[model samples]
Target: MIKRLCFWLRADRLGPDIPITHLMLYFPALMRMICSKRFNGFGEGSEFRPGAYADNCSSITIGKNVAVRPGTMLFAEKGDGVPGRIIIEDDVLLGPGIHFYCPNHSYKDASRPIPEQGYFYKGDIVVRRGAWIGAKSVILSGVEIGEHAVVGAGSIVTKSVEPFTVVAGNPARLIKRLR
Candidate 1:
């Protein structure tokens, strides 16, 4: 019900502060919004499935036929400064618990303590067209998953995955190239 209200609020069809109970009372309309791929957010023909978690700070630009599965979290840096943009090209499929982080904590300065460094470094995260990220995958900042690549489940992607390749495990070593 909260999701539906959020969608409606984004679409500007309904104002905020509309009681959740009332939205739930109109269950049919709520179902229509949830089931339909066209509502809220900036993505053409992209589907963020129910239970998918996206942060408000995140700026998501998606192309056609993109599917972000349930339990996936997309986080972007916040504040007055511009964070990073998350660009998911067409026909991308993201599985459950896939986390795309756009910001990294600064650890370069020897003089500054970790917590005292305070500044967040950001870099754009791009998942090119037709990439499939499997469940429990973690994609860090400044990395691009090339077109048609497949990331195996539980992989931690800290670097770029070449086009048409399949990668797995921590640090995501390339397992094979897809023909």
Candidate 2:
């Protein structure tokens, strides 16, 4: 029954979608326990709020004191005997509805439908220490948010951001340098 036990601890699919009832005051604590079991590394003092979704938890790691807000989705690629594909460093702030996608679907062939093109894997998506990602940001494959950087709300990050900088917009343009 080891497989069943693991599934119960993770609830990988259904757990994230379960809404917390008003009477369930310890819901976050329960989530923390579940994440610690599912994730590669669930850091000390970190919070993984309810409604945060992640599949293939073995490929994701969270550092100390990180906050993954509600509605955040961590879509990491499957572990091919490697891990840390989606790493969130210590002291990072992730806003609500943040989406971290590590796999990109192939669309190079115009002759075929996008779904028929299949999927491709990219490099890691890392959020360095002290970075603040605003609400509804979409961080795509192979992108890294540098230390102390700030991503504004509703931004679509397709590239790596520099340290101590501010980025926003569809492709996440440079707003200014903080350092």
Which one is best on TM-score? 2
How many residue pairs clash in model 2?
0
What global local distance difference test value does model 2 have? 0.80
Per-residue alpha-carbon lDDT of model 2 for 1-179, expressed as tens digits?
77765655555432344443111237767656666777888899898766677767777899999877778888887334333279999999888999988887889999999888777767899999999999999999889899999999999999999999999999899999997
Q: lDDT per prediction?
A: 0.70, 0.80
RMSD of each candidate relative to the true structure: 5.8, 3.5
Listed in order, each prediction's TM-score against the native is: 0.72, 0.85
Worst 10 residues of 2 by lDDT: 14-23
Judged by whole-model lDDT over C-alpha atoms, candidate 1 comes out at 0.70
Shift of residue 87 alpha carbon in model 2, Å: 0.1
lDDT of 1 by residue, 1-179 (tens): 77865764553221123333134335745533442422334455555555565543236666787766666777654323455667788889888889988776667789988766655644678999899999999998878999999999999999989999999999899999998
